[model samples]
Target: MPGYKNPDLEYLDQQGNVVGYGEVKTVGDADQSAFNKQLAKAVKQLRVREDVEGKMDVNEIFIQVPDLVDAREVRGWFRSYQKGRLHHGSDLEKISGYHVRVYTGSGSKLADVDLGVDADGGHYDESTHTYYSSNGYSY
Candidate 1:
């Protein structure tokens, strides 16, 4: 649409269908506010677009930030935002459908940070090879 915002990256499936949308923040020192704005905009755009909303499998949203930033702090900020949004009656579908991934230098490989909201309303944050649960437990 003419007034709709565009995502930084669109992930398509083999059938040329949009499966996910991504917003990338290239500034290594960018703060959580920037990321929050980018993600909120991307989600709003994706939710309003008919083509994207029609696809049931198109639920994943990616927030790509530079690897130089602190992943732990970024995840913390995202979780906090999510909690606040959920408490304020935001759509659950949008609040819990994001993944934060970091890219190192110019490599194609993605360092995935599995930040997911579980069925029990708990947060999952994974960095590198370690995993942390929302209940102040890490293994």
Candidate 2:
């Protein structure tokens, strides 16, 4: 018609080919509730597929720890002197014993030593010098 002032909706196929007639887009007589319900269902399905079951766990992930380390030891013999340079034992044995290394912020490295949690579990260095012990830790 000659005095048409409305836009048309051009339908396209899967291959982007125009195959059908055009229809005008309007808010007239639209089932908005049904459209919203379908949209919510699609979103729910996508969320379910990307759930925690589809994600990898910590045990399934792989990480590498260097056996031979060259960092500054904060406890035993080697200690840190400079700022931003802090290190503890790389080997499991050094941190296994009762006498563990402690760093004091009073300009003293290995200024204090504390006992571990028995012969099995170990002590935890809460702060630089503050130490706590636990016997339930695996390593």
Candidate 3:
């Protein structure tokens, strides 16, 4: 703690209690080309939170992305990005927060293949998993 700077921001609960540390980062990319780089920098900016997490009532690291781009657009791009990651075996877990968004897309035809096995299945055995399409792929 002596040589490290703390996270730039503090997250507080409704009662004004410190809950965690993080940063409010903005992603200006309207396309996928810079999304990964922007995301990595945002996460790196939160590294200082490691100092107090789980030690001072700080249980998390947060990276809040401002809606510089329209929410719908950011979400659309993110969904497509996620699908791309899955298709290539990339991990999205490193990004902060639990995502409830579905990553998938419906095929042009009944037999058209997309994210998984013919737009009906994907990377793993998802026969029983509930899926919703987003950006033309299934997760």
Candidate 4:
């Protein structure tokens, strides 16, 4: 919204008289680029939160360190992806904690699952093999 100002603050000349006419400008290329960058960052953060939350919602399943891989690492180096749709930060700034449960396989237990990473950039627990809850809030 455009702000309301005293008439003097608007079109006043050196003599404090209205010029009667002036130009109203639109956002320029630079402004658009800045907006885009900020938008991307926001999206990245949202995606990161969703991804972390999804994994944490999985039932309790404890696996060894050698079992699964960090999906983020496999994906790419993202300070935040797609502008911030996914924030690949040290901290998982989305989920509170995890609800883990194990499901046994018939013969082979493939360790190609999600290993939740906390905001501090640490694995939840190597032995428990479950995603950890945040400190009551996402950072």
Candidate 5:
């Protein structure tokens, strides 16, 4: 669908403008790198929200520290940067918003996979163990 964005949670103001939004993530604190990866996903979602809706003022990230990782070593660098699609600061501005096409080495057919939107869509290769949603579908 065109111009369609589904966010887990959305925030709006009195004028009904999209103010803030973010997705909830429950991650094990055993590894700092794993936690960082989860944080990166949230960052991208924050940009999508701002691009589709609006910007926010305050910035914050809350999470529990896993005893296995160094408490001070954990990076709290969750500053929000808006990466728009149709609006300002959108990286897709020059790409013409959904008009761009991808090509592999063959260049014969369009690529069907969009790995970026994995928070919703999930895929798994029998040869590999890249499981996104264990509850939705898994083998």
Candidate 6:
């Protein structure tokens, strides 16, 4: 726990269980370095929560960016980047067991784009700007 990083945002449910963790980055253009750094930090935080603390209840991990392109680039980097187990790439992939979400928005506004699955195993519907899971639940 001494060396573990902390995510920008940690969402918890009513029961105080960690439901998700998020990292927010507002940057100019698609800067891979900044994106990777923030993402890596979030992933490491999640790793400590999951692997070290045994918090298996966390359901999702997300990265929020002001630019959609940056979000896409971050997603791409997560999919392709390679690193050791305790490093960025692998830590990110590990947290993705609960699925990774990349939402584009700032402040407290509803996200313009939600790029991941919802709680019920369904993908976000871009057209409706809504999340519809396989169990017919919409969020």
- Residue 25: error of model 3 in Å? 2.2
All candidates: CA RMSD (Å): 5.3, 27.7, 10.9, 21.3, 17.2, 6.7
Candidate 5 lDDT score relative to the true structure: 0.37
What's each prediction's TM-score?
0.57, 0.18, 0.39, 0.19, 0.39, 0.49
Over 18-72, each residue of candidate 2 has an lDDT whose tens digit, in order, gives 4322221111122333322332233233223324234211111011112221112
Give per-residue CA lDDT, model 4, range 27-107, as digits (tens): 122233433343333333433443443332222222221223342321221223222434445343332232211112222
Q: Please report how far candidate 4 places residue 62 from its true position, in Å.
A: 38
Writing each residue's lDDT as its tens digit, candidate 6 over 22-98 gives 55555344555665566556556666766665655544445555544532344345434333333533343344455
When 2 and 4 are scored with lDDT, the better candidate is 4
Best by TM-score: 1
Model 5 stretches astray by more than 4 angstroms? 1-5, 14-17, 58-61, 64-70, 75-139
What local distance difference test score does each model get?
0.54, 0.26, 0.40, 0.29, 0.37, 0.49
The candidate maximizing lDDT is: 1
Predicted structure 1, TM vs. truth? 0.57
Tell me the tens digit of each residue's lDDT in model 5 across 15-110.
Answer: 986665545544465454555566546555555555665555422233343444331233111111112222354452222111111122233222
Model 5 Cα RMSD, Å?
Answer: 17.2
lDDT of 3 by residue, 1-139 (tens): 5425555567689999876654433334445456544544434444435444543343232223333433334334445655665777856554324222221122111111121112222232256332334324333
Q: Point out where model 6 deviates above 4 Å.
A: 5-29, 68-75, 82-93, 106-139
